[model samples]
Target: MCREPYPGRVTAPVFVLTPETVEPAGAAATAVAGDRLVLTGPEAHHAVAVRRLHPGERVDLVDGAGLRLVCEVTETAADGGRRERLAVRVVERVEEPQAGLQLVLVQALAKGGRDEQAVETATEVGADLVVPWMADRCVSVWRGVKAARGRQRWGAAAREAAKQARRARIPEVAELLTTAELAGWVRRVNDAGGLVLVLHEEATVPIGGVALPDTASSEAIDHPADEPRGGGKGPQDPVTIAVVVGPEGGISAAEVGALEQAGARTVRLGPHVLRTASAGPVALAVLAQRVGLWG
Candidate 1:
């Protein structure tokens, strides 16, 4: 039987295991209680040296793909070596279910680390996927090596935020998208019956008032089913909800027109204008509640 942990009483620090590390354990490895497991490498070093987690302490090991192992530390390296390892026994293995609605945040790259802040907050607020957008008025241009580095930074930020939030799944940071490419993506998602909302200060529709689609509908079209997200007993086709946030200079009218032409709905959050870093997270929180993700 699976041992249920106390609700709202999380006592252990979370350490994420990469897919490569967790996948080799196979599906049956952590299925039963009292299963022996070892946590090694950088994660273990951080747990022992940085966190000072001693034996008898509890910890949560997540694959960032729905698999979470609740473990009790049985032993720790006594030599205090830099490359230490931690051994634990699994108390329980839980496969977290996917959210009712898959939230996607398409944030335009901005200067002053504002884009990084946006993605970090969005991940903590339950955004399932994040896409970095190169807007027309973006002051921070990413080209060549800079683009790859920027995406890596964003992914790192999201991973840290997910760990802080104790999330079983980490949000994916997609490749950078130009305005035209973003429009194409919007069309593809729309064709799959997904909803895309572009945040505009001048829009007439309030984001809170938009009717959320029923994710339980079996007739819903599948959008990006190959996403690394795992853990569903049966097949489920959840509708994707994408929120677009502009850069520090704001979105250009031409870009807005292109997004609208591609079947995205322009919506306003409130009366006051928000900074680029705050807009997407706010919209995601509002939509998450409306779609029962908060429930």
Candidate 2:
């Protein structure tokens, strides 16, 4: 039996809408108050046709952009025995504080279906960003239509996983990057006042021992030409850390060289080897906890 309290019956169906759809001036004029935010979409279909949700029920809705709402259904539409519109009254709307640490996982594409698992776990564990790295050892080749499909699949998985974990924020999945492009990204992030940490099985230092780069030091660092003009300050200053995880066969010597050249610090996670799919999230969990984002 589960020891945790049951969240209670969901009265309103929760759905994710584009930022434009959730804006006050947009399609649905649902008011926000406390912890409740209200909106309706295909998620309504899932609630009615799938879950058979009815009026007076409650459900949690998130914009996947760090907004969460708890709402109660006030009205439901029936069209030829099929559910259509769902109107809900917002009971509460709460904005979660940003995680102290912004961890971006630059994961090397892996063979098989491991890449999807990596993205799903990364989102659930609180990664702020996910970047697909096309490393030298990557066995998975994403091109043309496959690339488009992969991006869609990854984004959908992240959204679904975020809801499952009850997270207010959903991480962004960046377009795929080649080794050279990834190095440039590392440089750009570092120049933008973020610290980049590359996970290497052969590294001697434990990840826990790694401290966020001091704000003062980050400000003193030079910014790359393409980096944003502002030095680390406010939300941007406190050590933006990127965790780079290699593929199943691991990062190549050249790839490691490129990262190091881009000023990424190599850190080890643990004694044993973790699968390509697990390393990124496990590292993220540790970082999130150290930074007080997780208990």
Candidate 1 lDDT at 183 equals: 94
lDDT of 1 by residue, 174-209 (tens): 889999999988887777678899999999999988
User: Pick by lDDT: which candidate is best?
Assistant: 1
lDDT of each: 0.80, 0.70
Worst 10 residues of 2 by lDDT: 1-10
- Candidate 2: list runs displaced more than 4 Å: 1-14, 19-30, 33-40, 77-83, 96-100, 214-238
TM-score of each: 0.88, 0.80
TM-score of 1: 0.88
Per-model clash counts, in order, read 0, 15
| lDDT by residue for model 2 (1-295), tens | 1111224433334566554433243533344653233344566656656666677887766666555566777666556354355566677765444433466888888878798899999988877678888888888888999888888888888888777776656777888999998888778777876778899999998999977754332222222223332124544433577899998888988998998998788999999899999999999888777665543
**C-alpha displacement of 17 in model 2, angstroms?**
2.9
Residue pairs in clash, model 1: none
Alpha-carbon deviation at 49 in model 2, angstroms: 2.1
